[model samples]
Target: MARAAKKDAGNDTISLIPDDPNVPRPRLHKLIIKNFRAIGAQPVVIELDEIVVLVGPNNSGKSSILRAYDLVMKQGSNEGKLETEDFPNGIVDNAALPEIELQTIVFDKAPGDRWIGATEDGEMLIREKWTWSSPNVQPKRQGFDVQKGDWDDQVPWGAPAVANSRRPLPHRIEAFASPEIQASEISNLLMGILKDRIKTHKTGGEGQEKSDYDQLMESISNLQKNVVESTKAEIDVVEGQVSALLEKVFPKYRIKLDAKPEVDPEKTYTPFKASADLLMGPQDGYFSKVSQQGSGARRTLLWTALKFVSETKTPNDGGTRPHVLLLDEPEICLHPSAIREARTVLYDLPKTKTWQVMITTHSPVFIDLSRDNTTIVRVERAQDNAIHGVTLYRPNRSKLDDDDKRNLKALNVCDPYVNEFFFGGRVVIVEGDTEYTAFSLVRDLFPEKYRDLHVIRARGKGIIATIAKILNQFSSSYAILHDSDQPETDKGDKNPAWGMNSGILSAVNSASDSSAIRLVACIENFEAAMFEKAATSDKPYNALVRIRDDEALQTKVCGLLDALLDSNLPVPDGCIRWNALEQLEAGVAK
Candidate 1:
């Protein structure tokens, strides 16, 4: 109160204000790969979101994309050496050189801003090219060039000397998998954590008063000094004799020993070089080496450790730089629940640490279709066997109707099998669980037809149209089977199946090409139709259950279905309409 009374009439006080909120941070914007591994001469441009998920069949170039990106952004060591097998088709003769280009956008001033010169469009371009000595020889990196240009600019330019300069960014890019989890890796991680903590405390001035760290450092110094002194004393005892012998052999020459421990406290004491062992086991039990741990346990530990390291800030003199994690098949060897947990961690990484995450996965457990920030890139080979670029699909909640959005959310929450749709080549959508079960049982009968086909349960006639729309968006070839549920003329308008039929018809009519889509309406419900054709009994569920659980029953059911399918007569009692079976067969034949 007394100080307030002394306020001057003409105030000259200045207020502490923060920087402009409009300032944008630097981030990796896109990646372009050309003629690299499975990728063809055409450049595949992939826009990077906070979290990028690459999903495709095996050998479809998903891993190649990750490896290419890793090659560009990797630092500290050159561990990725291009081999002969890395060439497309394992052939390099008369082939185009492999190229990888990275696009980075900066919105604000950064310490390493000088390392990257902005293009006319205000973006940085880093390009790497590789060439092989011959078709049979392995490919070697030709040059890494950085320039200022638009990301999509196809013009070629001469290499710049700046490409050989050191990277100014303070970040680390690492790949995590079962094979990368080793004792040395664990030790290095521990050392990084310890160094970060120590730096944090020292910077905050909280540990200055505590002499424990200082005392430890002093002890280390003394130990190093003692070792050097003892070694030098031992060397001195032999120095005279050795020098005399050397002088006698050569009068103008003399030899002397210099025994000194060339020790760098910081590097020599790092966890990687230091003799540090981690023993882990149950309490009150004899401990075992970490190497002896089970695969699952080791995986869990590695995951936990990575999660911690990724979230923690690495102490640096320069400002913190952005980090991007490249994970290839993180679901490998993990339990189903653990895979889901991993998904959660990946989803949270951007928010928690502002880090970018890229994952390649074949498991549905790793995908959450409802997430907004996540971008799913579908990588597939072209019909001509040429490497095709990835198709990026970002789930926009605004584009979906409220009802459709709710349905999608429910599917994510209740149906774990929904992800299989993304991985399958063709989809067979049926109404309810009974149809799904029956189709699954008969699927093996047509191995060629159903080799890459995935059967999904729509649970109701109302949802069949929704499923069809979703599948269509994925560019998936699909067949829909449902009951006609025809009612009396007076009540036909009120039948639920009628509405479903209309919806299905509407979707089909709106399609640009409907050749890939097939629809069949059963004359009656699934059970009624199956019971009418039952060879042994009228109980449809029992018959289907037997077919699913008993190999003998499955053989019998297959035989009956095949016989009925082969017959020319109208099979009104068949589980599936005769017309539907004919249409399915015709579609498969095509």
Candidate 2:
């Protein structure tokens, strides 16, 4: 079994070398797209990270980046030829021919520079262009242009040898979309693995030991022959009936059925292929069709199967081609738990450096900020409105402190709700779990107003500033809520600015815009203030007891906040925090 490899220092490419110490994997370093759909005339250059993730809003060209890669690499056979609508704004008449250029670094053990003009960094450029004489043409003429050396001073478009060498790179591009895995796809994947294993077994050398292998192969051949024969016999019966019906109906014309075997028996007999169509349900029963299962189940099954096949080694003879896995929206139609499981698989997939995985997704469930090697590309419509521009966000050590880095790394892994901020329009950063709970209850009061606002726990007062700074980097508007911890002394009561000078509060205030980042400090702590306010009620003891009980806390908090908003009584001292919340909401509205 082939194990996943660790990243070599400074190397962004996967290790192409199998078990051999000398072989090097070909790595995709950069991609350049020009005049492609949703991409303008100015070339969009993207530097490939080890695990590249593209994320953005709808129609912002996130999928277009993946398609650009597919168009150039031809990952699958049915990528559909470049049509007129594929051009930007569906206008190809006045536009220049669309182009996709790829730069890769290949390390070959057997020496003779396979690259035309190899760069000092061992990078080579392969450019694919689509040209059509007229818009009416069904398929455009595709051309390959390869260049090596510096970006400037490159060769012309027709270099066959370099182009041929780069063809293997495309074979390495394997793209999988969500929930739509065809039967043929599963069959092909399984067949490829079985073929590689059989080849490996045969090359292990000769002896009586080979007899067992030969016998197994013979059994497989016999079974395949029987199946083919039975299939043909059935086809013959159907064809005969059709022909008889046609003769009776037309008298002059007869139907001829040419039912040749769709799959070659020699290539079709494999353990993997035999089990490709089989599906095990949640219970003991077997599902006849994968399509019958829920979308989440189907996606999980396909992803698991692909992961299994990817871990298998290629034939020693180098017959199997390497590929980069391109996945689009793996989180689609998945349950939360299933999405998390998918995230683990995706995160670990590219770690072995066996194959690179590039995914485009809108779901934050798929985003893991901890992994240093994962490259996040935010794609959005450019301000100029000509095309979409992509911004790369890689984990860097320079900008963040160790503690802040650890918090970010632990976010999705330990804190499941932090990712909600990514999907939200505004954020409310509260100091602890209690604050989070209270605010969440409060948010339910105005569902429409708070629909786009996400509440996140900062875990500690010290971390609130850090969380605010991090959110700022993503251009998020956030407000902070924390306990002032003010003492109940005469001097403290006299000073209205008691908690305003705290280090955490000062850090937050200085780091964020005064309007966008509002800070609310409870005079004595959230629970204390809530209790104080409930004390003013007619049944003070009962209200405090209701707030104390876990079951009643949520409802009581809602009732308390509602009462405060209605101005049914004098505002309680604890309810002063609501003013800060109002200001925050007003700023967010602006």
Candidate 3:
């Protein structure tokens, strides 16, 4: 596993180094795209992790990032050719040519030709440029010149040579979102596994097994030669006729039919050359081809095949290629239950140390903030009509202790909607159900003004700090509103609830330096501050009923809503620092 760190020169490039030298597996660290479709002239830098989940609305460039990665890493798929539409805004001029830079951490023990230019931390920077002054052009690799401090665009390497030099280069498997699954697709996946097995059949095997495998390959080649020789007499008849017809036309040239057999058994005897039909039926009944079933069944079959590959594929054991799985919307066509299972499979695929997973999803079920080595990036089209990606959550910046981690996990399990804020713009974190219900009603009153506003119910005071720390880690500006719990209990008391008030305020201050943070609290509790007395039970119900009947309370709640929703509105009796709460208590206690 690797960790992200800033360069000493303070550039925007993110450098990755392994946390432990013993765990040396090649992995992608970061990707930068410029002048690509959906992404404009301004570069969009995405920091990769073991499991990266990209979430956003439709056409927000999430799929573009995944496709760009596939285009660069995987060879012979369109052969790195770029169409006019691939350029930004469908313009294909020199300035609009697309370019992508990939930064990868390659361990010395990994099985590949280690390229020359590598940083001291063992990170390799490879640049891919589409040097097209016209349409349908090919891309080239630009190696970085450490001495010149620039890219050597004229690196004398073709795409195939570059791909071959890095033998067993991370085997990339793409499962882009699709409604229908063809039998050919399944055959291709199975053939990939079979091809890999055949390639490594003799590795670490007994001497007799290795000799048998070599003899098998040799026998296949001999059979091909024998077949060609057996067919030569029959082919000579056609060749004679063709040559005679050619002599009648020109009398100077002759034609011959040359039949050459493919000698490679891996190519001649793979699953791709045959028809693959998947049948599904009850144990005691007749089976039908899966193509006859609905899209859901086919999609489920595809997912099962992917899970199979992830589990049964060769592990990255210093002699095999590592795998990169670029999946787009694994949740598509899946039932809610199946989607959850898919999420787990995609997440756990990388744990085997053989595969790394990247996916674009619209489901919050795929986003988990508590997991290490997981990154959640929110991709969207900005107001300027360019795509922008913001990493809304990463584990390293959480600053969470063990207690916080336990509390965060408990919150994640208990609250099904805790991850919804990643899809919203401006967020408001409330302590419990009371403020969530009341402020939600207020937000509904003015929907357009607060279109992007999302109010998250933290469910308890203790979990507010954890949630706030996560929001702050991604530099998300948000407002925190909770009960001070002060007049009911002394602020200096040892009560944990009392302590969380200051704890929550401290989180706000830590985030306020980089992003806007506002804190507004009820003096004693929501019921007391709004209805003039604390509720014995049903606090949220009481607050909701009172606000509906009482006009004055609505006006006051609207004032608080302004502070929580609007960036310009100042919070009432807000404290930036934790200890400063006491001085502001007098103002809030009114």
What is the per-residue lDDT of model 3 for residues 388-506, given as tens digits with 9 covering 90 to 100?
A: 88887778767877877887668767775678888767788888898888888777776787788888888898888888888887754677877776534454556566677778877
**Ranked candidates (lDDT, high to low):** 3, 1, 2
Top candidate (lDDT): 3
Tell me each candidate's TM-score.
Answer: 0.61, 0.59, 0.77
| Residue 318 Cα positional deviation in candidate 1, in Å, after optimal superposition | 13
lDDT values, one for every candidate: 0.57, 0.55, 0.67
The residue pairs in collision within model 3 are none
Candidate 1 on 1-590: residue-level lDDT in tens? 00111211223121111023333234566777877778878777777777888888787888788777566434224434466666677776565666676555444332132234554555543333444344333334332323333232231122221221212221222234333346546555556567545533453364464334444555676787788786786777688778888888889676677554433344345424454666678999989867678766666766776677667654332223345667778786687777767777778766633367788888877777566667777888888676665544555522445565566667766776676877646666777776666667677656874577677777667766666665656553456767666543464466555545666666655555665565555555656555444334444466566667777655544543343323432333333432333443333233
lDDT of 3 at 387: 91
Instruction: Give the CA lDDT, 0 to 100, for residue 185 in model 1.
Output: 60
- Against the correct fold, how does model 3 do in TM-score? 0.77
Each model's Cα RMSD: 13.0, 14.1, 8.5
Candidate 2: worst 10 consecutive residues by lDDT?
108-117
Q: By descending TM-score, how would the candidates be arranged? A: 3, 1, 2
Better candidate number, 2 or 3, judged by lDDT: 3
Residues 103-171 of candidate 2 have per-residue lDDT tens digits of 655544211232233444544333333443334443342333232323332222223233333333331
After superposing candidate 1, which stretches have Cα over 4 Å from the reference? 1-27, 89-95, 110-292, 306-320, 378-386, 484-516, 528-540, 543-590
